[model samples]
Target: MAYKITDECISCGACEADCPVGAISAGDDKYVIDADTCIDCGACAGTCPVGAPVEA
Candidate 1:
């Protein structure tokens, strides 16, 4: 499953750099993970300070 970024995201851009597939992007309100491009590696989740990334 792909990972989803929750509203708790701080948009600090840490997760974006951790995403191996470049699935994470900056959104209007927060960082978003492109489900189609995500590899489900959980790298972004590990890097998120607010625990915004979760399995979807």
Candidate 2:
């Protein structure tokens, strides 16, 4: 499964830069992860300071 950005995201932009596949992006209030583009690499999850990224 691909990773998802939870509501806990602080929009810090760390995950965006950490996403190797460029799946993470800025949403209206938080960051969102593109499930189709995500490679399940967990890079975004690891980079998230608030632990917003989780496996979908």
Candidate 3:
């Protein structure tokens, strides 16, 4: 499953920087993930300080 950024995100760039496949990007309110590009490696989840990234 792909990882989705929940509202818990603090709009930090940590997940974006840690996403190995470049699937994460900055959104208007938070970070968004490209499901198609997500490798489901949980890299974003691991790096997110707020634990906003969740499996979807």
Candidate 4:
């Protein structure tokens, strides 16, 4: 499954650089994960500071 950014995201942009697949991007309220591009590697979840990424 791909990872999703929850409301807990603080927009710190930490996960953005760590995403090897370039699946994450900044959204209006928070960072968002492109499910189609995500490789389900859990990289985003691992890189997030606030545990904002969840398996979707």
Give me the candidate number with maximum TM-score.
1
Select the stronger candidate by lDDT from 1 and 2.
Answer: 1
> Model 2 clash pairs?
none
lDDT of 1: 0.94
Which portions of model 1 show Cα errors greater than 4 Å? Answer: none
Candidate 4 stretches with Cα past 4 Å from truth are: none
What TM-score would each prediction reach against the true structure?
A: 0.96, 0.95, 0.96, 0.96
* Candidate 2 accuracy as lDDT: 0.90
Per-residue accuracy of model 2 over 5-53 as CA lDDT, tens digit each: 8889888999999888898889999999888999999998887889999
Per-prediction backbone clash count: 0, 0, 0, 0
Q: Using alpha carbons, what is the TM-score of model 3?
A: 0.96
Error of 3 at 54 (Å): 0.3
Deviation of model 2 at 43, angstroms: 0.4
Candidate 1: give the clashing pairs.
none
**Model 4 residue 19 lDDT score:** 97
lDDT, candidates in the order shown: 0.94, 0.90, 0.93, 0.94
Against the correct fold, how does model 1 do in TM-score?
Answer: 0.96
Stretches of candidate 3 above 4 Å error? none
20-42: candidate 4 lDDT, tens digit per residue = 98999999999999999999999
Please give, for residues 1-56, the per-residue lDDT of candidate 3 as tens digits: 89999999999799999888899999999889999999999988888888999999
